[model samples]
Target: MSAKNRDNKNRWRNITVGFRVSPEENELINRAVALSGLPKQEYCYRRCLNQDVVVQGNPRVYKALKTEFATVLAELKRIEAGKGVDDELLSVIELISIILGGLKGEDANGE
Candidate 1:
């Protein structure tokens, strides 16, 4: 390899950083890394650098919940159009609306 290319490749990631952790802290760190769905080193590097880490939910569960809200949405539309909806159904639908909004990562007030 040319001297410049060799130097460039070597300099890309030449730093090594590490610290000791207690058993409890190690377990917690492992759990966090797993939850992040990233490799342990990458998770630690991102966290240490204070980068925003977005932990998304399981795709299957998210999709399932969204699908479940479809029925509630239809009911809500019916209620909005002057159809009689029971008090219990209305309450449940309201709650579901809140939950669906939250799942979409919006604030309770839809901000």
Candidate 2:
């Protein structure tokens, strides 16, 4: 067998998911991950590993939701530019997350 095949057989079999996107989308995704202070692949891997994440959704709808989330986060920053996390704001964030988490499909359950 090939060295590549031997290596593949020895490694853990993580399921693969692929994407097809234009260069612009790739750049945007890279920027987003960088802004989060994580390497691009690490960001993707952590997101994939996190069972609490909403596993499946309509891509466009998910993108729209994420866009709106960024907008809300920006609004919070403007409101508290030099301040730390406010208790009320943190609670709101948690509530929003819980609502969003409910929108996911079930394949991710108990992961």
Candidate that scores best on lDDT: 1
Q: What TM-score does structure 1 among the candidates reach?
A: 0.43
Instruction: Write model 2 residue lDDT over 64-105, tens digit each, in one string.
Output: 457647856886887777756655445445534554555543
Question: Considering summed lDDT, which 10 consecutive residues are worst modelled in model 2?
Answer: 1-10
Write down the TM-score for model 2: 0.29
Model 2, position 58: C-alpha lDDT score: 55
**Candidate 1 residue 98 C-alpha distance from true site, Å:** 16
Give each model a TM-score.
0.43, 0.29
lDDT of candidate 2 at residue 9, scale 0 to 100: 35
Query: In candidate 2, residue 63 scores what lDDT?
Result: 69
Q: Go through the candidates in order and give the C-alpha RMSD of each one to the true structure.
A: 13.8, 12.6
User: What is the Å distance of residue 18 in model 2 from its true position?
Assistant: 3.6
